[model samples]
Target: MEPLGQDEIRASFVNCTRGEAKGVTLPAPPSEIPWDRREFLGWRDPKAPARAYLVLPYGGEVIGLALRAAAPPKSRLRSNICGFCTTTHGLADITLFSARRAGKAGREGNTLGTYACGNLACSQYVRGELKPDVPQPYESLTVEERAGRLEEKLHKFVARVLESR
Candidate 1:
Protein backbone atom coordinates (compact mmCIF):
# COMPACT_ATOMS: atom_id res chain seq x y z
CA MET A 1 0.00 0.00 0.00
CA GLU A 2 1.08 3.58 -0.61
CA PRO A 3 2.38 5.60 2.31
CA LEU A 4 -0.53 6.80 4.48
CA GLY A 5 -1.55 10.42 3.95
CA GLN A 6 -2.79 13.05 6.38
CA ASP A 7 -6.50 12.65 5.55
CA GLU A 8 -6.48 8.91 6.21
CA ILE A 9 -4.75 9.38 9.51
CA ARG A 10 -7.29 12.04 10.49
CA ALA A 11 -10.25 9.79 9.73
CA SER A 12 -8.66 6.98 11.69
CA PHE A 13 -8.37 9.34 14.61
CA VAL A 14 -12.11 10.07 14.48
CA ASN A 15 -13.11 6.43 14.23
CA CYS A 16 -10.80 5.43 17.03
CA THR A 17 -12.00 8.16 19.34
CA ARG A 18 -15.67 7.43 18.69
CA GLY A 19 -15.12 3.69 19.36
CA GLU A 20 -16.24 3.02 15.81
CA ALA A 21 -12.90 1.52 14.94
CA LYS A 22 -12.40 -2.07 15.93
CA GLY A 23 -8.61 -1.89 15.62
CA VAL A 24 -6.25 0.46 13.84
CA THR A 25 -2.63 -0.58 13.83
CA LEU A 26 0.09 0.59 11.48
CA PRO A 27 2.91 -1.92 11.31
CA ALA A 28 6.37 -1.09 10.10
CA PRO A 29 7.57 -2.84 7.01
CA PRO A 30 9.37 -6.07 7.92
CA SER A 31 12.44 -4.93 6.00
CA GLU A 32 12.83 -1.95 8.32
CA ILE A 33 11.64 -3.04 11.74
CA PRO A 34 11.80 -6.55 13.19
CA TRP A 35 8.55 -8.55 13.08
CA ASP A 36 8.16 -8.78 16.84
CA ARG A 37 5.15 -8.26 19.08
CA ARG A 38 6.60 -4.96 20.20
CA GLU A 39 6.75 -3.97 16.53
CA PHE A 40 3.20 -2.69 16.94
CA LEU A 41 4.04 0.43 18.89
CA GLY A 42 1.12 2.58 17.83
CA TRP A 43 -1.14 4.71 20.01
CA ARG A 44 -4.04 3.37 22.09
CA ASP A 45 -6.11 5.35 24.56
CA PRO A 46 -9.83 5.37 25.30
CA LYS A 47 -9.90 8.73 26.99
CA ALA A 48 -8.18 10.77 24.31
CA PRO A 49 -10.30 11.08 21.19
CA ALA A 50 -8.10 12.84 18.64
CA ARG A 51 -4.74 11.17 19.12
CA ALA A 52 -2.80 8.62 17.06
CA TYR A 53 0.61 6.98 17.27
CA LEU A 54 3.28 6.95 14.62
CA VAL A 55 5.95 4.28 14.44
CA LEU A 56 8.51 5.82 12.10
CA PRO A 57 10.76 3.16 10.61
CA TYR A 58 14.01 4.26 9.03
CA GLY A 59 15.66 0.87 8.82
CA GLY A 60 16.47 -0.49 12.29
CA GLU A 61 15.75 2.97 13.65
CA VAL A 62 12.55 3.05 15.67
CA ILE A 63 11.39 6.18 17.47
CA GLY A 64 8.17 6.26 19.42
CA LEU A 65 6.09 9.38 18.72
CA ALA A 66 2.73 10.31 20.25
CA LEU A 67 0.51 12.51 18.07
CA ARG A 68 -1.76 14.37 20.41
CA ALA A 69 -2.30 17.75 22.00
CA ALA A 70 0.33 19.69 23.97
CA ALA A 71 -1.89 20.50 26.90
CA PRO A 72 0.06 20.14 30.17
CA PRO A 73 1.70 16.73 30.79
CA LYS A 74 1.05 15.87 27.17
CA SER A 75 4.43 17.45 26.50
CA ARG A 76 6.42 14.51 27.80
CA LEU A 77 10.08 14.03 28.62
CA ARG A 78 11.62 10.89 27.17
CA SER A 79 15.12 9.88 26.08
CA ASN A 80 16.00 7.84 23.05
CA ILE A 81 18.56 7.86 20.24
CA CYS A 82 17.76 9.92 17.18
CA GLY A 83 16.20 7.86 14.42
CA PHE A 84 18.46 9.54 11.88
CA CYS A 85 21.58 9.90 14.00
CA THR A 86 22.23 7.06 16.42
CA THR A 87 23.86 9.16 19.10
CA THR A 88 23.26 9.26 22.81
CA HIS A 89 22.27 12.87 22.19
CA GLY A 90 18.66 11.77 22.41
CA LEU A 91 18.83 12.18 26.17
CA ALA A 92 19.87 15.83 26.21
CA ASP A 93 19.61 17.08 22.66
CA ILE A 94 16.07 15.89 21.98
CA THR A 95 12.97 17.72 23.15
CA LEU A 96 9.48 16.44 22.46
CA PHE A 97 7.16 19.34 21.63
CA SER A 98 3.49 19.84 20.75
CA ALA A 99 2.79 19.51 17.05
CA ARG A 100 -0.11 21.23 15.26
CA ARG A 101 -2.29 18.85 13.28
CA ALA A 102 -3.84 19.22 9.84
CA GLY A 103 -7.06 18.08 8.14
CA LYS A 104 -9.04 15.82 10.50
CA ALA A 105 -6.17 15.36 12.94
CA GLY A 106 -6.41 19.11 13.29
CA ARG A 107 -10.17 19.19 13.14
CA GLU A 108 -10.31 16.66 15.97
CA GLY A 109 -8.47 19.35 17.90
CA ASN A 110 -5.59 17.14 18.98
CA THR A 111 -1.94 17.91 19.60
CA LEU A 112 1.15 16.04 18.50
CA GLY A 113 4.10 15.16 20.70
CA THR A 114 6.89 15.64 18.21
CA TYR A 115 10.21 14.29 19.37
CA ALA A 116 12.68 16.50 17.58
CA CYS A 117 16.38 17.19 17.97
CA GLY A 118 16.87 20.43 19.89
CA ASN A 119 19.52 21.55 17.43
CA LEU A 120 19.97 21.10 13.71
CA ALA A 121 22.13 18.06 14.33
CA CYS A 122 20.44 15.58 12.00
CA SER A 123 17.97 15.63 9.15
CA GLN A 124 14.53 14.78 10.48
CA TYR A 125 13.87 12.17 7.75
CA VAL A 126 17.28 11.09 6.51
CA ARG A 127 19.07 8.32 8.37
CA GLY A 128 22.29 9.44 10.06
CA GLU A 129 24.47 8.94 13.08
CA LEU A 130 23.82 11.64 15.65
CA LYS A 131 26.92 13.02 17.36
CA PRO A 132 25.72 14.90 20.41
CA ASP A 133 29.01 16.66 21.01
CA VAL A 134 29.92 17.16 17.37
CA PRO A 135 28.61 19.96 15.19
CA GLN A 136 25.90 19.37 12.60
CA PRO A 137 26.82 18.78 8.95
CA TYR A 138 24.07 20.78 7.25
CA GLU A 139 23.69 24.52 7.55
CA SER A 140 21.39 25.41 10.35
CA LEU A 141 17.93 26.65 9.50
CA THR A 142 15.73 28.92 11.56
CA VAL A 143 13.30 27.29 14.00
CA GLU A 144 10.47 28.38 11.70
CA GLU A 145 11.95 26.53 8.77
CA ARG A 146 12.53 23.41 10.79
CA ALA A 147 9.02 23.43 12.17
CA GLY A 148 7.56 24.04 8.75
CA ARG A 149 9.36 21.09 7.28
CA LEU A 150 8.22 18.88 10.10
CA GLU A 151 4.64 20.07 9.75
CA GLU A 152 4.63 19.36 6.04
CA LYS A 153 5.81 15.81 6.51
CA LEU A 154 3.45 15.15 9.38
CA HIS A 155 0.44 16.49 7.54
CA LYS A 156 1.25 14.26 4.59
CA PHE A 157 1.02 11.20 6.75
CA VAL A 158 -2.04 12.36 8.63
CA ALA A 159 -3.79 13.12 5.37
CA ARG A 160 -3.33 9.52 4.31
CA VAL A 161 -5.32 8.32 7.27
CA LEU A 162 -8.13 10.74 6.50
CA GLU A 163 -8.39 9.59 2.87
CA SER A 164 -8.54 5.94 3.81
CA ARG A 165 -11.96 6.57 5.28
Candidate 2:
Protein backbone atom coordinates (compact mmCIF):
# COMPACT_ATOMS: atom_id res chain seq x y z
CA MET A 1 0.00 0.00 0.00
CA GLU A 2 1.11 3.58 -0.63
CA PRO A 3 2.58 5.08 2.50
CA LEU A 4 0.11 6.99 4.61
CA GLY A 5 0.72 10.74 4.35
CA GLN A 6 2.19 12.69 7.27
CA ASP A 7 -1.11 14.34 8.04
CA GLU A 8 -3.01 11.11 7.76
CA ILE A 9 -0.63 9.34 10.10
CA ARG A 10 -0.91 12.17 12.56
CA ALA A 11 -4.67 12.04 12.34
CA SER A 12 -4.55 8.31 12.98
CA PHE A 13 -2.53 8.97 16.09
CA VAL A 14 -5.18 11.36 17.26
CA ASN A 15 -7.83 8.74 16.75
CA CYS A 16 -5.91 6.14 18.70
CA THR A 17 -5.12 8.55 21.50
CA ARG A 18 -8.73 9.59 21.77
CA GLY A 19 -9.78 5.95 21.93
CA GLU A 20 -11.83 6.40 18.80
CA ALA A 21 -10.51 3.27 17.12
CA LYS A 22 -13.12 0.92 15.70
CA GLY A 23 -13.20 -2.79 14.99
CA VAL A 24 -15.37 -5.21 13.08
CA THR A 25 -17.71 -7.44 15.01
CA LEU A 26 -16.20 -10.86 15.59
CA PRO A 27 -17.52 -14.13 16.92
CA ALA A 28 -16.33 -15.41 20.28
CA PRO A 29 -13.43 -17.80 20.16
CA PRO A 30 -14.28 -21.44 20.88
CA SER A 31 -11.71 -21.51 23.66
CA GLU A 32 -10.35 -18.63 25.68
CA ILE A 33 -6.85 -17.57 24.65
CA PRO A 34 -4.14 -18.48 27.13
CA TRP A 35 -2.35 -15.75 29.08
CA ASP A 36 0.98 -16.24 27.33
CA ARG A 37 -0.64 -16.03 23.91
CA ARG A 38 -2.67 -13.07 25.04
CA GLU A 39 0.48 -11.15 26.00
CA PHE A 40 2.15 -12.15 22.76
CA LEU A 41 -0.85 -10.95 20.79
CA GLY A 42 -0.94 -7.60 22.64
CA TRP A 43 -4.18 -8.43 24.32
CA ARG A 44 -4.34 -7.46 27.97
CA ASP A 45 -7.10 -10.00 28.32
CA PRO A 46 -8.37 -12.51 25.78
CA LYS A 47 -11.95 -11.56 26.41
CA ALA A 48 -11.67 -7.95 25.18
CA PRO A 49 -8.60 -7.51 23.04
CA ALA A 50 -9.01 -5.06 20.20
CA ARG A 51 -8.71 -7.41 17.25
CA ALA A 52 -10.36 -7.11 13.83
CA TYR A 53 -9.90 -3.35 13.76
CA LEU A 54 -9.55 -0.74 11.01
CA VAL A 55 -8.69 2.96 11.17
CA LEU A 56 -11.45 5.43 10.48
CA PRO A 57 -11.96 8.75 8.56
CA TYR A 58 -10.23 6.92 5.80
CA GLY A 59 -12.99 6.87 3.25
CA GLY A 60 -15.38 6.50 6.14
CA GLU A 61 -14.49 2.88 6.93
CA VAL A 62 -11.93 0.93 8.89
CA ILE A 63 -9.79 -1.64 7.06
CA GLY A 64 -8.73 -4.82 8.81
CA LEU A 65 -4.96 -5.08 9.10
CA ALA A 66 -3.26 -8.06 10.66
CA LEU A 67 -0.14 -6.29 11.80
CA ARG A 68 3.25 -8.00 11.78
CA ALA A 69 3.89 -7.93 15.53
CA ALA A 70 0.73 -9.88 16.27
CA ALA A 71 1.59 -12.80 14.00
CA PRO A 72 2.10 -16.17 15.61
CA PRO A 73 5.61 -17.61 15.93
CA LYS A 74 4.38 -20.00 13.26
CA SER A 75 1.38 -19.71 10.99
CA ARG A 76 -1.68 -21.68 12.00
CA LEU A 77 -4.74 -23.21 10.38
CA ARG A 78 -7.92 -21.17 9.87
CA SER A 79 -11.42 -22.47 9.29
CA ASN A 80 -12.89 -19.04 8.63
CA ILE A 81 -12.95 -17.35 5.22
CA CYS A 82 -11.52 -14.00 4.26
CA GLY A 83 -14.00 -11.21 4.79
CA PHE A 84 -12.66 -9.23 1.83
CA CYS A 85 -12.41 -11.83 -0.92
CA THR A 86 -14.85 -14.23 0.67
CA THR A 87 -12.46 -17.10 -0.12
CA THR A 88 -10.70 -19.19 2.43
CA HIS A 89 -6.95 -18.78 2.58
CA GLY A 90 -7.28 -22.54 3.09
CA LEU A 91 -6.85 -24.19 6.45
CA ALA A 92 -3.09 -24.23 5.98
CA ASP A 93 -2.57 -20.84 4.33
CA ILE A 94 -4.39 -19.05 7.10
CA THR A 95 -2.25 -17.09 9.55
CA LEU A 96 -2.75 -14.41 12.20
CA PHE A 97 -1.43 -10.83 12.15
CA SER A 98 -1.54 -7.90 14.58
CA ALA A 99 -2.88 -4.48 13.81
CA ARG A 100 -0.70 -1.38 14.33
CA ARG A 101 -1.90 0.82 17.16
CA ALA A 102 -0.56 4.33 17.53
CA GLY A 103 0.27 5.17 21.09
CA LYS A 104 0.15 8.43 22.96
CA ALA A 105 2.82 10.96 22.00
CA GLY A 106 6.09 9.09 21.53
CA ARG A 107 4.97 5.71 22.72
CA GLU A 108 4.21 3.00 20.18
CA GLY A 109 2.20 0.13 21.55
CA ASN A 110 0.92 -3.18 20.22
CA THR A 111 -2.76 -3.62 20.86
CA LEU A 112 -3.43 -7.32 20.70
CA GLY A 113 -5.16 -8.75 17.62
CA THR A 114 -5.51 -11.88 15.50
CA TYR A 115 -6.55 -11.72 11.89
CA ALA A 116 -6.93 -14.48 9.27
CA CYS A 117 -4.45 -13.06 6.76
CA GLY A 118 -0.78 -12.59 7.50
CA ASN A 119 -1.05 -9.61 5.23
CA LEU A 120 -3.46 -6.88 6.37
CA ALA A 121 -5.53 -6.38 3.24
CA CYS A 122 -9.17 -6.71 4.25
CA SER A 123 -10.81 -6.39 0.84
CA GLN A 124 -14.30 -6.93 2.21
CA TYR A 125 -13.90 -3.81 4.32
CA VAL A 126 -12.48 -1.61 1.56
CA ARG A 127 -13.48 2.05 1.87
CA GLY A 128 -13.15 2.89 -1.81
CA GLU A 129 -15.87 0.78 -3.35
CA LEU A 130 -17.57 3.71 -5.07
CA LYS A 131 -14.51 5.84 -5.64
CA PRO A 132 -13.30 6.56 -9.17
CA ASP A 133 -9.54 6.59 -8.67
CA VAL A 134 -9.11 3.14 -7.12
CA PRO A 135 -8.64 0.05 -9.26
CA GLN A 136 -9.93 -3.48 -8.80
CA PRO A 137 -7.95 -6.63 -9.45
CA TYR A 138 -8.35 -8.34 -12.83
CA GLU A 139 -7.82 -11.80 -14.25
CA SER A 140 -4.58 -11.09 -16.12
CA LEU A 141 -2.64 -9.06 -13.57
CA THR A 142 0.51 -10.28 -11.89
CA VAL A 143 0.92 -10.22 -8.11
CA GLU A 144 2.76 -6.92 -8.32
CA GLU A 145 -0.01 -5.47 -10.43
CA ARG A 146 -2.66 -6.44 -7.93
CA ALA A 147 -0.64 -4.99 -5.07
CA GLY A 148 -0.14 -1.75 -6.94
CA ARG A 149 -3.84 -1.49 -7.59
CA LEU A 150 -4.63 -1.89 -3.90
CA GLU A 151 -1.97 0.62 -2.96
CA GLU A 152 -3.58 3.21 -5.15
CA LYS A 153 -6.94 2.46 -3.60
CA LEU A 154 -5.56 2.91 -0.08
CA HIS A 155 -3.89 6.20 -0.92
CA LYS A 156 -6.98 7.51 -2.59
CA PHE A 157 -9.05 6.58 0.41
CA VAL A 158 -6.72 8.45 2.76
CA ALA A 159 -6.77 11.49 0.55
CA ARG A 160 -10.53 11.43 0.45
CA VAL A 161 -10.66 11.29 4.21
CA LEU A 162 -8.38 14.29 4.55
CA GLU A 163 -10.41 16.17 1.99
CA SER A 164 -13.61 15.56 3.85
CA ARG A 165 -12.27 17.01 7.06
Candidate 3:
Protein backbone atom coordinates (compact mmCIF):
# COMPACT_ATOMS: atom_id res chain seq x y z
CA MET A 1 0.00 0.00 0.00
CA GLU A 2 1.15 3.53 -0.76
CA PRO A 3 1.41 6.25 1.80
CA LEU A 4 -1.80 8.22 2.35
CA GLY A 5 -2.06 11.64 3.89
CA GLN A 6 -4.86 12.81 6.15
CA ASP A 7 -6.57 14.65 3.31
CA GLU A 8 -6.65 11.53 1.13
CA ILE A 9 -8.09 9.46 3.95
CA ARG A 10 -10.78 12.05 4.64
CA ALA A 11 -11.63 12.28 0.95
CA SER A 12 -11.67 8.54 0.37
CA PHE A 13 -14.55 7.69 2.68
CA VAL A 14 -17.63 6.60 0.75
CA ASN A 15 -19.76 5.18 3.56
CA CYS A 16 -19.58 8.17 5.87
CA THR A 17 -20.53 11.82 5.87
CA ARG A 18 -17.81 14.38 5.23
CA GLY A 19 -17.91 15.54 8.84
CA GLU A 20 -17.43 12.01 10.16
CA ALA A 21 -14.55 11.37 7.83
CA LYS A 22 -12.80 14.47 9.05
CA GLY A 23 -13.07 13.26 12.61
CA VAL A 24 -11.38 9.89 11.97
CA THR A 25 -8.04 9.79 13.71
CA LEU A 26 -4.61 8.77 12.47
CA PRO A 27 -2.24 8.05 15.28
CA ALA A 28 0.73 9.19 13.23
CA PRO A 29 1.50 11.15 10.09
CA PRO A 30 1.41 9.37 6.71
CA SER A 31 5.18 9.30 6.41
CA GLU A 32 5.48 7.55 9.70
CA ILE A 33 3.34 4.62 8.62
CA PRO A 34 5.07 1.35 7.79
CA TRP A 35 3.56 1.36 4.31
CA ASP A 36 5.57 -1.48 2.79
CA ARG A 37 4.24 -3.94 5.30
CA ARG A 38 0.61 -3.03 4.96
CA GLU A 39 -2.02 -3.95 2.40
CA PHE A 40 -4.53 -1.50 3.91
CA LEU A 41 -4.66 1.01 6.72
CA GLY A 42 -7.25 0.06 9.31
CA TRP A 43 -7.84 1.20 12.87
CA ARG A 44 -10.52 1.82 15.42
CA ASP A 45 -11.51 5.32 16.48
CA PRO A 46 -9.32 6.17 19.44
CA LYS A 47 -12.18 7.83 21.26
CA ALA A 48 -14.91 5.38 20.20
CA PRO A 49 -14.14 1.69 20.52
CA ALA A 50 -17.21 0.73 18.54
CA ARG A 51 -16.17 2.77 15.51
CA ALA A 52 -13.54 1.63 13.05
CA TYR A 53 -12.32 2.46 9.56
CA LEU A 54 -10.50 0.92 6.60
CA VAL A 55 -8.70 2.49 3.64
CA LEU A 56 -7.07 0.61 0.79
CA PRO A 57 -5.86 0.87 -2.76
CA TYR A 58 -8.69 -0.06 -5.10
CA GLY A 59 -8.74 0.20 -8.89
CA GLY A 60 -7.22 3.59 -9.65
CA GLU A 61 -8.04 5.24 -6.36
CA VAL A 62 -8.17 4.74 -2.63
CA ILE A 63 -11.47 3.71 -1.01
CA GLY A 64 -12.44 4.02 2.60
CA LEU A 65 -15.23 2.60 4.74
CA ALA A 66 -16.55 3.53 8.14
CA LEU A 67 -17.33 0.44 10.21
CA ARG A 68 -19.21 -0.31 13.41
CA ALA A 69 -18.76 -3.36 15.62
CA ALA A 70 -21.75 -5.54 16.29
CA ALA A 71 -22.74 -6.32 19.88
CA PRO A 72 -20.41 -8.58 21.86
CA PRO A 73 -20.99 -12.27 21.47
CA LYS A 74 -22.75 -14.06 24.33
CA SER A 75 -20.70 -17.25 24.08
CA ARG A 76 -16.92 -17.39 24.15
CA LEU A 77 -16.19 -19.92 21.42
CA ARG A 78 -12.64 -21.26 21.52
CA SER A 79 -11.87 -20.69 17.83
CA ASN A 80 -12.83 -18.38 15.03
CA ILE A 81 -11.33 -17.27 11.75
CA CYS A 82 -10.89 -13.82 10.28
CA GLY A 83 -12.28 -13.49 6.78
CA PHE A 84 -9.38 -11.37 5.57
CA CYS A 85 -6.22 -12.96 6.95
CA THR A 86 -7.63 -16.46 7.32
CA THR A 87 -5.99 -16.73 10.71
CA THR A 88 -7.53 -18.62 13.60
CA HIS A 89 -8.29 -16.65 16.71
CA GLY A 90 -10.04 -16.98 20.02
CA LEU A 91 -13.64 -15.79 19.73
CA ALA A 92 -12.78 -12.65 21.65
CA ASP A 93 -10.12 -11.71 19.09
CA ILE A 94 -12.64 -11.71 16.28
CA THR A 95 -15.40 -9.17 15.70
CA LEU A 96 -18.41 -8.80 13.47
CA PHE A 97 -17.95 -5.42 11.82
CA SER A 98 -20.53 -3.82 9.59
CA ALA A 99 -20.14 -1.05 7.08
CA ARG A 100 -22.98 0.95 5.65
CA ARG A 101 -23.40 0.67 1.91
CA ALA A 102 -22.45 3.61 -0.20
CA GLY A 103 -24.85 6.24 -1.62
CA LYS A 104 -28.62 6.04 -1.05
CA ALA A 105 -28.56 2.50 0.31
CA GLY A 106 -26.40 3.58 3.21
CA ARG A 107 -28.67 6.51 3.92
CA GLU A 108 -31.58 4.06 4.06
CA GLY A 109 -29.72 1.97 6.73
CA ASN A 110 -28.34 -0.84 4.56
CA THR A 111 -25.14 -2.48 5.69
CA LEU A 112 -22.91 -5.57 5.23
CA GLY A 113 -21.00 -7.27 7.98
CA THR A 114 -18.12 -9.76 8.13
CA TYR A 115 -16.04 -11.35 10.84
CA ALA A 116 -12.48 -10.09 11.09
CA CYS A 117 -9.59 -9.62 13.44
CA GLY A 118 -10.86 -7.27 16.11
CA ASN A 119 -7.78 -5.10 15.85
CA LEU A 120 -7.90 -4.88 12.02
CA ALA A 121 -4.27 -5.93 11.70
CA CYS A 122 -4.67 -8.59 9.04
CA SER A 123 -1.75 -7.30 7.05
CA GLN A 124 0.62 -7.99 9.88
CA TYR A 125 -1.03 -11.28 10.74
CA VAL A 126 -0.66 -12.72 7.24
CA ARG A 127 2.99 -11.71 7.12
CA GLY A 128 3.75 -13.43 10.43
CA GLU A 129 4.46 -10.12 12.11
CA LEU A 130 1.49 -10.72 14.37
CA LYS A 131 0.05 -13.92 15.74
CA PRO A 132 -3.42 -14.86 16.87
CA ASP A 133 -4.02 -16.12 20.41
CA VAL A 134 -4.55 -19.72 19.32
CA PRO A 135 -2.29 -21.84 17.15
CA GLN A 136 -2.93 -21.39 13.45
CA PRO A 137 -3.33 -24.44 11.24
CA TYR A 138 -0.39 -25.07 8.94
CA GLU A 139 -0.85 -23.81 5.41
CA SER A 140 1.00 -25.08 2.35
CA LEU A 141 0.67 -21.69 0.68
CA THR A 142 3.53 -19.25 0.91
CA VAL A 143 3.36 -15.83 2.54
CA GLU A 144 2.87 -14.09 -0.80
CA GLU A 145 0.04 -16.42 -1.66
CA ARG A 146 -1.63 -15.74 1.67
CA ALA A 147 -1.17 -12.02 1.21
CA GLY A 148 -2.72 -12.22 -2.25
CA ARG A 149 -5.70 -14.02 -0.79
CA LEU A 150 -6.06 -11.31 1.85
CA GLU A 151 -5.97 -8.59 -0.80
CA GLU A 152 -8.58 -10.41 -2.87
CA LYS A 153 -10.94 -10.72 0.08
CA LEU A 154 -10.43 -7.09 1.02
CA HIS A 155 -11.28 -5.97 -2.51
CA LYS A 156 -14.43 -8.03 -2.53
CA PHE A 157 -15.57 -6.52 0.75
CA VAL A 158 -14.95 -3.04 -0.55
CA ALA A 159 -16.82 -3.82 -3.77
CA ARG A 160 -19.82 -4.95 -1.81
CA VAL A 161 -19.90 -1.70 0.09
CA LEU A 162 -19.47 0.33 -3.11
CA GLU A 163 -22.17 -1.56 -4.98
CA SER A 164 -25.03 0.75 -5.88
CA ARG A 165 -27.75 -1.86 -5.57
Considering every candidate listed, which one attains the maximal lDDT?
3
- lDDT tens digits by residue: candidate 1, 31-140: 55322312123443345534445543322333234454333233354455443223345255554544345346645665444544444233432223324554545646
Better of 1 and 3 by TM-score: 3
| CA RMSD (A), model 2 | 15.0
Per-residue lDDT of candidate 3, residues 34-132 (tens digit): 999999999888889999999999988999999998776988587789989899999988999999999999999999999999999999999999977
Whichever of 1 and 3 has more lDDT, that candidate is 3
The deviation in Å at residue 104 for candidate 2 is 9.3
Poorest stretch of ten by lDDT in candidate 2: 35-44
Which one wins on TM-score?
A: 3
Better of 1 and 2 by lDDT: 1
Q: After superposition, how far is residue 161 of candidate 2 from its true place, in Å?
A: 20
Compared to the true structure, candidate 1 yields what TM-score?
0.30
- Our model 3 lands, by Cα RMSD against the true structure, at 1.1
Lowest summed lDDT over 10 consecutive residues: which window, candidate 1? 33-42
Could you tell me the lDDT of residue 109 within candidate 2?
49
TM for every model, in the order presented, reads: 0.30, 0.30, 0.97
